[model samples]
Every structure is written in C-alpha cells, then in structure tokens.
Target: MNQSRKLCQLCGLPLTEDQSFLSLLGIMSTDSNNLCEDCCNQLVLINDIFCPNCGRLQATPEMCFDCIRWQNKGYPLLEHRAIYQYNDVMKTYMQQYKFNGDFLLKDLFNHDLIRLIDSIDKDIVVPIPVSHYTMQTRGFNQVSGMLNGQTLSDILSVTASKKDHQSQFGRRERMNRQQPFALSVSSQLVVGQRILLVDDVYTTGNTMYHAANLLYQAGAKTVKSISLAR
Candidate 1:
C-alpha cells in the first residue's frame, strides 16, 4: 500500500479511508490521522481527579505533595495539564521518538496536542528549548516538533550545555535542580502576558519550574504548562 494512503505511524497498520461512522452518516472525511485505534486506546489519558498544580493522576482533585513543596519554597503557583500518564507504553514511545530520533513519530501526537493547546487561553505558547548539542544531534526539539509548525514564542533558550539530564537524577536531585534556562530576548514582550509553557513530558517538573520561574520574574502575569505525558 502507498504510504500516502495512511498507515498508522506507530504500527504501520493500513487504515481504512474512514471508520464505519462515515458509512452510517453518508459523510466522507479525508483527514488521515496518525495512530491506529488499537494504539490510540493503549494511551492512558489523565483523569479528571488529579493534582491541580501538576496534573498528576489522583483519587481527588488537589495539589500533590511536590506542588505543595514548590509553593513552600517560594516558587510561583503554576498550573499544569498533562494529556497522558507516563506508563510503560509511553516510556517506550518516548524512547523511540525522542532518544532514538524518530522525527516522524511526533505526528502520532501532534493533532491531539494542537487541539488541546487550542482549548487553553494564553497570550503566548513557549516550548521548552533544547540545548545546542541536543538540537545538533536530535535534529529537533521534541516539544517544538509536537506543535506541528504552530507559531511559538522563541524567547526562552538553554544557556549552557551540560552533559546531564533531569531523568538521570533521583527525586532529591531533581528537587534541587539549578536553573538551566535563560531568556534569549528582552522580557518586555513577556510582561503582563499569560504564558503557556509546552514540553513533551513532565517528570519531576524541575524543567517547567526552571522555565516558569524565569518567566514570572520577567513579568509574566500567569504561567501554566502542558506536557504530552506526565
């Protein structure tokens, strides 16, 4: 089958032109989405009862312990929303798309993500930037790639190249993480604007805080984040 005819990006399964709903409605839809039904069903989306601050799944809607600690430490209260849980399937997907540099794999989540981003009210959308080394090797920032060519603020930048990653650290180390980002442009643009920070995953959330802290200091009115996976 021709690749243009729409095979699932993850499993390479040949997709029908449209699901049976089209036949029932007698409406022809031509949009070719990436993931197959089986692959889509495997994703564990975050539930309504989750931490309001960090978007972690929970029995009730409340701030998680980590978010409480963040507030106690004088960090600004930044609300976050995550689309899916970082389960074994998500881990494998991240490894293949990000670490393994499978560029096209981003299409699997792009449409869903764009729809989610659209629902949020923000003056600017800023994706966490990748280091120079990472961009050279990975060929793209995973967060930016997930936005599917949408216009995003390029204000935040990774200042220095460190051979370290947040995933390499323990929880304690992540909590003590130092600032890794800097503003590339003047803060005048960010002042008094509601900002939405975007990233591929939310681990310890050290990265988001690092970025939000700077944005708040730069005069952002409100800061919120969205990650594809928690």
Candidate 2:
C-alpha cells in the first residue's frame, strides 16, 4: 500500500491499524481510511428520522416547520434527501473543502454520494451552479466536485453575480432573496424529465426551492433534490 494513502484524508492519522486483518493481507480492501474511524464517526448520518420534504433531522418523519412554511407560501413541495446532519464535524469539513479551496477533500464523500444518486429515480442530475465570482475565486464548484465522474446535466447557471455569500445571511434573509438561477439550455431538454438537483448543503431550503421552481416552470415532470448536509 502507498504510504500516502495510509494516512487519513481528514485528520492525517496513520490508517494501518484502522484496517482489518483481511485488508492488511490483501484479501479485502481498506476500510474508512479516507477518514479514520474516529473522524468518520464524528459525522452524523441522516439515516434515522428526517423530514420527508426537506430531509431536516427531526423527531418524526414528517414535513418540518420550514417545509410547511414553504407549502403555505404555495411553493411546490420538493422531496429532498441529505446524507448527513450539518453538525460540527460537517461544518469543519465544509470550511476546509469549500471556503478554504481544499479540492482533494471532495473524495471523502464521492463514493457515498455516487451510491446515493444511483438509488434515486431521475432522468438527469443537475448541480447547483456558483456565481462567476465564486468560480473565479474558488476554482471549482463544491457540489459538482462531490459527484466524481457521474454524468451531469450542465443546464442550470447563475443568473447574475452575487456580491454576498449565502452564509452571511440568516434563514429569513435567505428565504427572501430573489431567484439566483436560470436555465442555460433550452426548455425542450427539461420537458417531462425527472430532474435531480444537487447541492453541497441545505440551509433554509430556499436555494433548492428556487432551482426546483425554475425546473418546474421549464416543464420538468418532477424536481427532487439531495444535499451532502442539512
């Protein structure tokens, strides 16, 4: 095994002892070395109860208050799923991978994200786009980086340059923000298609709703969404 690969990607710890005997003997592949078991366990997976509409962690698997508010506002309900809770571990991971431009960190979630996408029913997958300024400064779109080499529909694009980051805004401010995305391709391509919108995080559910609304208006049959965290 490569010495470099033996170090955990997140915490930079030695992964030798973390591997099972079979893996060390070449009978099985290494397990969870991209993140050591300790680091991996710190992430809270959203496998238990979560909201059906927005995938927010909750006591029951029902539509959350935020989703209910969106519903009351007459926005189309988006069936969204997320892989993990936006806990401290996930927050640090996002800070490093996204804000700090640590592109290699994307590999930490690529395999799991790909598997999750494969299980979804969708005609095409569209990643949420970043603004031109973000692309220039960040060098890559965080959401797209997690997709690995999967086929993606590059149809949606940023409507205009954003002067402020979404993180700077509160939930109410985010929900009140104007639509920030538009279709890059013709409506014919989206017509009657089951589109899956992908993003790095689900905040107030505003970004996903805005994107889904555009797709719905473009004649999409359905618009579902998934995020790395909520």
Judged by lDDT, which candidate is best? Answer: 2
Cα error of candidate 2 at position 188, Å: 1.2
Per-residue error (Å), model 2, residue 46: 0.8
Per-residue accuracy of model 1 over 1-230 as CA lDDT, tens digit each? 45347776667787655533343453321122555556656778785688999999889786988999989999887789988889876787888899889887877677668877898999999999999888988889999887886789989999755656665778888778678899998999999999999999988888999999999999999999999999
Report the lDDT of model 1 for residue 32. Answer: 29
Model 1 score (lDDT):
0.81
Overall local distance difference test of candidate 2: 0.84
Candidate 1, which segments miss by more than 4 Å at Cα? 1-6, 13-33
* Per-prediction TM-score: 0.86, 0.91
Compared with the true structure, model 1 gives a TM-score of 0.86
Q: For model 1, state the Cα shift of residue 25 in Å.
A: 9.2
Clashing pairs in 2: none
Total backbone clashes of candidate 1, pairs 3 or more residues apart or in separate chains: 0
Runs in model 2 lying further than 4 Å from the true structure: 2-5, 20-31
